[model samples]
Target: MRLKDPMKRLNAGLLIIAFVLSLFAGRLVQLQGIDSGKYEALAMDQRLRRIELPAVRGTITDASGRPLALTQEARGVFADPSLIDPAKRTEVAARLSSMLGLDVQKVLEAISTPDSRYVVLAHSVTPEKGRLVLSLGYRGIGVVPESRRSYPSDAVAANVVGFVNQAGDGGAGLEYAQNKLLKGVPGWQRVEISAGDGQHIPMGEGQTQEPVPGQGLRLHLDQDIQWEAQTALADAVKEFKAESGTVVVMTPDGRVLAMASVPTFDPNEYAKADSSELQNRVVQEAFEPGSTGKVITAGALLEEGLVTPESTFDVPDHLWKYDKKFKDSHEHETYKNITFGGILAKSSNVGTIMASENLPDDKLYNYLTAFGFGAETGVGLPGETRGLLHPPSTWSGTDRYPISFGQTVSVNSLQMASVYATIANGGVRVTPTLVAGTLDEDGAFTAAPAPASRRVISEATSHQLIRMLEGAVGREGTAPAAQIPGYRVAGKTGTAERYVEKAGGYKGYTASFAGMAPADDPQLVVQVVLQDPKKKYYGGDTAAPVFQKVMSFALKSRKVPPTGTVAPTLKMFAD
Candidate 1:
């Protein structure tokens, strides 16, 4: 009986041991099979860190590869509010504020929130500033390398290159128009790091996908010419005490060499610039072209064979149209017989209107439309305005006559400039383009799509109009100031009274000069417009002088050969 009891106790002990082992095995299965993914995810959350890799914006360059807008490498300063010491918070805030130009109170508020693990202190912290902050050994504050958008030349091409916002995206000008191509794809970095310090863990796994850099832009603008145009426009505006001004320089090929607007601002400190200064007035502001519209009328009539250059018209001092009577800029003796070219040289409103009498309103309107009036130039700049061009049905019987002289018709600076450029280009209208092409990081170039082009008038007629325009620049003509010393120049001067909403009539005057140089075989076309001049408001006195300077500089700079000889003599008036 003693032996049996011992054996039974042994068996019971073994059975207890087996049951305990089975329970442990079942627990192991639950942990290793059903809940394995859940614990693994929890460990990954604590161990791995994800850092966003920012993409850079493209560089904007002048035609000569001069940097206008660039993405400069910089460092961004940030703070971990959860890690910041409460007692030393004030001192830390002051240090950051002084070094980074941040507001002290704003930094204090950001550092005081314990729930925030990340708070941005300065967006574009310079490397020097970042080093200074890090040298102070603030435990919670950190610095990371980033890109700071910079304009190297302050206010040089303000309206063209524009300025970027806090997010580093282009907000205006060419930057805004080509935003998609300029901004590159962003990427990410996955790294295993300690949660407490954000330091890479020893023997940790990491993977990084580098961000692709953006393509670079190459513009059609010559930096030197742009500087000249901007300087000239600014000087003219200040000298005349005008409200605003604009100048556009182009070539026969329709390349916009420079487009400048006054009331300008430095794009570098765009935040301080007013909204009005940011607008590119060359393409946005519209005005009645006044007598400048005569070029289109002359060309239209000449192209249709309705009038020859030597055709005669009896020009009276004043013509009554409906209740309104039209008069010249100043009273002049009536010409009993005036050739078409002579009328243009004198800018006779009566002469131009009488010439337009033969052409139907529909034909005149079509010619105006063909000249690119009342439409966008598709220059690809943002905020481009299409000036108003009403249909023929909207015009009264007398409206056509006034429209012939550039009243009751509106056009922007570029449109007006393009009119002369068309004539200079032998009547083929080429779309004006600012962008030359895009350059990739590999130093490869992608040319911008060629601008659309179409013929507006016969080349033979263009030659005849060019001859008349040359007469308009003669000493006896309106724009004697537009004469260049060596080059044979051709252009027109226009002074149009600006309309007032309250008066429903003209108030201020917009003086404008549009012309091309080396008239025999033109290479460049320069346009200048001055608005609300406090001094002299005539196009010949105010705007024509500006054109002279710009065209002179461009002609000399381009090294264009001079015609040397005087223009062909046009009969001032037919006897």
Candidate 2:
């Protein structure tokens, strides 16, 4: 090898240094001047990643703090499609399918998508399954922890509390109506990005923002009382062979303690049931109230000072005029002149019409409106109906006559309950409430206030009406089965012929019983209705027994003290 001179070596070193400097300068210019925006964006993309954190939904509790609906932590499985190898897609999908019960082919297709970076394998998988999947040490598999809405009471207040969909949105009942209050805000997180396959890398910014959970709801439903009502209503439906049935129990102050409908559906399995079964019939379905509406008619008449409890009427069996023959549900070969109280106790249509004949159509309509008829209660529920009560001006001659006996008009079970509640609470009509309060994410209570009441009848008139109703449950009156052993229950029984849309006439019947217990100091009002009972269709036989079972349990559960030692006056008809 030829030895180079020292000058040549020094020159070569300088040139090498120049070359290195130029290369470095070119790189600096490319980063800072030519593509500065791209470099800045790459730096930010490495330092941050937007991630959505769902808010926790609140609990739904009954009056006694029993949870009817609640939330539980669940994990959602997802796959990093870009990181998953095309060859192993089938294998990975098969493993996940076996574990999560997902379709293997579908999952494989999802993970093998060319442009997609992520795919959700399953949602709401149990903790055990999630842990098993996590232990697999798969590079592309990931999990996002989430909260799922659950019904602890299951079918128990299904229609009232309602349910949430997969997207965690409210669908019906209080859930849909109060969505704004129930659904809380969501939050987000950020993370670093790495080189090559765009993988997440930790950069010390720690979970960027903590998620805020959803608010809770407190309902006026008493779980025990609700159970009582449901049991009774279900039994009535089966025993009477009814198409459907509804029962409503509320406090004298208008808080709905319990509302049950037979042929009810479970919220968890709501998708499997018919739309009709999901409805709250107490507020939805309307029926001709029959003799039970005598209470309202009596209220109107007494409030206007048109009749007294002791007033006598020489009522005949057949009112031939108006093409309407008024007859008692029970036959009387030899009718006797009875007192106003007797007429009501026997539920005579002639007596009721005679009493209502003097009141103007305007007065009747006004009273009905005051009692919350032909109007929605404005409860926070989905599809609340304003029942059909035709304007009094539309009343025909026969229509007027039949309306006096609750034939032409239609009212819901809830409205019927409120009518008795109004009488029980000294003629003050209060709006019914389902939810008691809402609890914010911070555990602060935002309670709903009790509805205001309007007086529709005098205290004296209310008391007089109670006395007359007392006679209806006494000896020589109908609804003898409604008599409880220890408590003094006063109520009315109704058997209305259901109108047939196809036939354009009345064919079937709806048996109903509406009353307030203990008559002296009313604590609760309950209504029971059975539609289209087979074999026996009388309200006294078909519906009254169901009321007895529920009322007995309700009195015991609420610890309502008995008013007197006197037993319910038993009545019997001659064989």
Candidate 3:
């Protein structure tokens, strides 16, 4: 409203303009210098994309390098929820479900996660399907290279090789036991992406770290023998109407050539299998070895000079010891002056108890422990039970007598097999082993360390025991069915009262047989066990035949010829 000088007004306007420009300059300095890292991080967060590159899982191979469990090339379907149109998420999920065979709801839930930048919709998708998914060109949808676990042999060695879960973790068996060594290390990729479309920018700043592939496992298992043993065990289980069955084939030095369990599940479809079938019975399940356990007593007797193979015992039909009446497997007249060898050959409970009478309780327990009972065989398997063995201090008055005959003690099949293996190895107990070595990505093999070993009995005593065990497979012995043609077989039969937890007492019998071939100079040992057989439950009738079939195959496959020496006849009666 007042007339003013033009020059003054112009000067005042210039000063206001200078003040505004200074404020802007100060803000620029703060953003470019003081808060530069913070602002740059926010900007990069919007443009940078970090992707996970999955590591290729290892292969599980037999001793001959036959792949049992392997990993195959696959793809993982993922989504950027922020890039997807909110209104079209349902449609995208429906399309993805059809292409990937995924549940629409699950896919929808994954992609619809609030404020998620990346979401995994499915894993282990076939490459073809992944390409098909890419063909749709749906915004925010992508696929990354991945691996899928496969079992080419189906159910063969399933219990030992184990299966992988959908999340790519080991579910059981050696897979679970050695997962860290097998899974290896994962990697990653970082790249700049377009903010508008989320597509990786060409020639943009990018970095990739290659994944380290998992180390492969080479086992002592022979796939052929594994398949044979599995088939044979399954057949035996079905034929005998037994609840389950297990078999273990090992070298005298404790290399597990074949370990099989019946009712095994296919690792490919492990999701559909019952949890019970996933266990490896050879190492996980434990039961009384019965007369098969008598070898320990025999070792104790001979090692301590308590008795010789010719030591006589008047084995009665029944004997009362600490309020428990022990009887032979079958009705028989009193064995007048039966030799110690005859007691084991016949698998006589009363005779075994009588033979162990002079042996101290602590000494018997020591022999059992030394033979690897009540402890794991160190076979490198997961969930291996030590089995149940009470010390002499914990033994009840009757416990000593029953345990002397293998009644109170419990042992897994692998441990029982090692017993005969130890005896076969001239009394040295070699720790059982399944894995032969580990293989690198380039196929270089690193052999595992040698298994631990210790002397369990004198070499002379072992030879004598082997000779005595040969009588058990002879014509007059209990397990004639275990004999292989042209092979000098030696073994023991076991038929023990099976204790069932649900039944609260002994409900059925566990039939088992453990033997070594060419008894004159043992090379291989095999143990067979059947649980709760319906019809015939004798170890000689049911389990021995399996032992014969499996042992015969193993012997032939290994090219182990017979010793060509006839087994010397041992005295059954001293009189």
For each candidate, give its TM-score against the true structure.
Answer: 0.91, 0.88, 0.92
On residues 1-575, what C-alpha lDDT tens digit does candidate 3 reach at each position?
A: 55399888888889999999999999999999899999998888877778877778889999999999999999988888888898999999999998777889999998889878878888889899989988888888887778899999999999999988888889999889988889899899987766666666778877899999999999999999898899899999999999999999999999999999988999988988998899999999989888899899989999999899999988888989867788987999999999999998988989888888889889999999999988888988899999999889887788888888888789999999999999999999999999999999998999999999999999999999999999999999999999898999999999999998788989899999999988988989999999999989999999999999999999889899887888899789986
Overall lDDT per candidate, in order of appearance:
0.86, 0.80, 0.90
lDDT-based ranking: 3, 1, 2
lDDT (Cα, 0-100) at 556 in candidate 3: 88
| Global lDDT of model 3 | 0.90
The true-versus-predicted C-alpha distance at residue 146 of model 1, in Å, is: 1.1
* lDDT, residue 299, candidate 1: 92
| RMSD after CA superposition, every candidate | 4.1, 4.0, 3.1
lDDT of 2 at 13: 83
User: Model 2 — TM-score against the truth?
Assistant: 0.88
Steric collisions counted per model: 0, 2, 0
Between candidates 1 and 3, the TM-score winner: 3
Mark the regions of model 1 whose C-alpha exceeds 4 Å error after superposition.
1-49, 191-206, 500-505
Give the TM-score ranking, best first: 3, 1, 2
TM-score of 1: 0.91
Tens digits of lDDT, candidate 1, 1-575: 35568789899889999999999988888788888888877887665656566788888998889999988888877777766779999999998888887799999998897666667777766788878887887767777667888898888888988888877678999878888778787777765645565444657876788988888899988878888999999999999989899999999878988899998898878989889899999998888898988999999999999999999978888888788788888887788788999889888898888888889898889989898999998788888888878999999868898888898888889988888889999999998888899989775879998899999999999999999999999988899999888789999989898875568888889999999989999999999999889899989999999999999988887788897777789877766
